[model samples]
Target: MRGRDEESGEFFSPSRSQNRRDALEVLALGEKLVALTEAQLAKLPIPDSLLPHIRDCRRITAHIAHKRQLAYLAKQMRREDDDVLDAIRDALDEDGEAARREVAAMHRVEAWRERLLADGDAALAQLLDEYPTADRQHLRALVRGAVDERNKNKPPRQFRELYRELRELIVGGSAGTDEEDADNVED
Candidate 1:
């Protein structure tokens, strides 16, 4: 039949081709999801039940089996809330943005470490004011060790450690110390 019926003056429902195209779009989204690493996929707003199907699809090697798995994924997606589709789309789009922000954060930490090493007490004071919870004594020791290593032409172990400590302080370390330890700190 034609797209519209003249007798009723009402538009026909979605055509079969339109329905197929929509299903294909969803399948394509499923394929994109399968391409993602498990950690990336975990960030998606999909149901927990669908995760095993997706992981199974990732493990499948044969073309026919993979195709069937993708079809299953599509079926599962259809049953999930509509918001899951939008969430997947948004997460994929934000991947680049997230990467850029991570790089910027790394650069900022590196700059702070370098400034602390070069500018000495002034930089330390500024950093302490910024990260009030940071251990001032530890930072002073690292700076001293790094300088001594530089003078003696020894391995830059302390320099590396300083970088690591700065990174922890700046990025919010999981096991970071919170004590001010001000009385024990030395100049």
Candidate 2:
């Protein structure tokens, strides 16, 4: 029975059902952690104390053994403070946001590439306007080579090179802009 103050009627502890629910939640989180690759795990804010437990859980291949090890990992994870768990969750959430930003940047690069191919100098002027540090003459040469390759039905070596150049320029520029935006927000 949960202890309660006689006058105020406030419970001092959670009931058994709540305890089981909390345990299951931790178990589910442990399963997710175990499923992640080593590189992926490095990106999260997991604690050193739970690392061994997580690794052991990951090493088990047998169904029953893995389940048992997972339960053990969950028990260990339950010992962590709520703040630690929240930090890990936030890191995981940030990974999705970071991936979305990267995809958006790639799409932006591809769109610029198509515009450059289609509109030639007009699009080049717009690109240089945004990324003033870009090499104007080099980009013009690339666009010319790409257009030549397309019309001649030759290999797309220049086309691919243009894509590589645009990806490097635009991805780097977008990262800089994101940082500037954050700094502006702070001010």
Candidate 3:
């Protein structure tokens, strides 16, 4: 319905359009929250009051129930501070990136393990050169045990150990200390 006409002014329901936009935005947030895993949700900075709404949405499996829960969540979300939503989105994005990096690191470690197993001494020498502090004798024993286990078609106990050691040596060892050393150098 037109409200009033003032000197060629057109009447429109701007509030209705704004309400629809707000509802859509809130529903989008509800969708994102619903897609998040429990662990991810824990990381988000959501307030205690909103947790039940979010959890209820997650628990509702029926399509209609889920839709109703989502509507409730959207209404609740509209009452929250904008920063809370921003924080939740940021945390989820950060967690996603962290998970991706972890997967990539695992794949890289696996590739290195395979290379070390296939190339034997050549790869060992490369590993030693790269990680001077690595225990050569221990590594050789693990590698030998891993090879024996493979040849015998036994459970990959030693193979798993070898991967663990390589991961500890290459990934865990390098992730720390070096950054601190760099910071020290600047002092």
Candidate 4:
């Protein structure tokens, strides 16, 4: 003999019963609505004031039907991987102008990136050569300083003092003076 829990009671089968009841009610209501004339349906309290809602429902139904037809056509056109590849190749061959334009656009982007890399690399290499003894931290600080200086000389706000401060911190370990400073000063 099987035992059921007292708390759960009846095995939670409300969904099946509720779904069937709801579907039957919907079918009956739909038949009733269909039998009513437009004027007769308009007399209904909610429908009388919400003509736009009724129109929107009709539009949604038509859109759903159109989408279903499109989906059926797409499903019917499904093919093997090789067949799809062949079809794509045939389509591309038929559109030679479009293929050429795509290739040209790709080449242009490649050329632009190559130019940017060349310019950036040249600038980075020059900065590295200038600070040959400097470590990675020093190099980053130097680049940051230069960018700050360039930004200050341009527009709304001044940045020369900020650049000088960062430059001093980079050369002289954030504490005070650098090793080279002591060597340069005569006793």
How many clashes (backbone N, Cα, C below 3 Å) per candidate?
Answer: 0, 0, 0, 0
* lDDT by residue for model 4 (1-187), tens: 3355588765544566776665454344333433445675554432232344334343454667744533333233232243542433333353654465444443433332233234444544543453354354543444455455555665412233333433433343322333332332221
For 115-177, candidate 3 gives per-residue lDDT tens digits of: 777878887887787689999999888888888899999999989999899878766877754
Candidates' TM-scores? Answer: 0.64, 0.65, 0.55, 0.22
Whole-model lDDT values for every prediction: 0.78, 0.84, 0.78, 0.41
How well does candidate 2 score on lDDT at residue 114? 83
Q: Which portions of model 2 miss their true places by more than 4 Å?
A: 1-19, 42-51, 79-96, 152-160, 176-187
lDDT of 4: 0.41
lDDT score at residue 140, model 4, on the 0-100 scale: 49
* Per-residue alpha-carbon lDDT of candidate 2 for residues 119-185, written as tens digits (9 for 90 to 100): 9999899789878999999999999999999999999999999999998887765665854433422
lDDT string for model 1 (1-187, tens) is: 6478789877688878987897898899899989999788776676788889889999998999999999999998888777777666666765655455556556666777777778888889988986788999999999889888988999999999998898788766422332232211222
Worst 10 residues of 4 by lDDT: 178-187
User: Considering TM-score, where higher is better, how would the candidates rank from best to worst?
Assistant: 2, 1, 3, 4
Segments in model 4 whose C-alpha atoms lie over 4 Å from true places: 1-5, 11-13, 47-53, 56-187
Pairs with backbone N, CA or C atoms under 3 Å apart (clashes), candidate 4: none
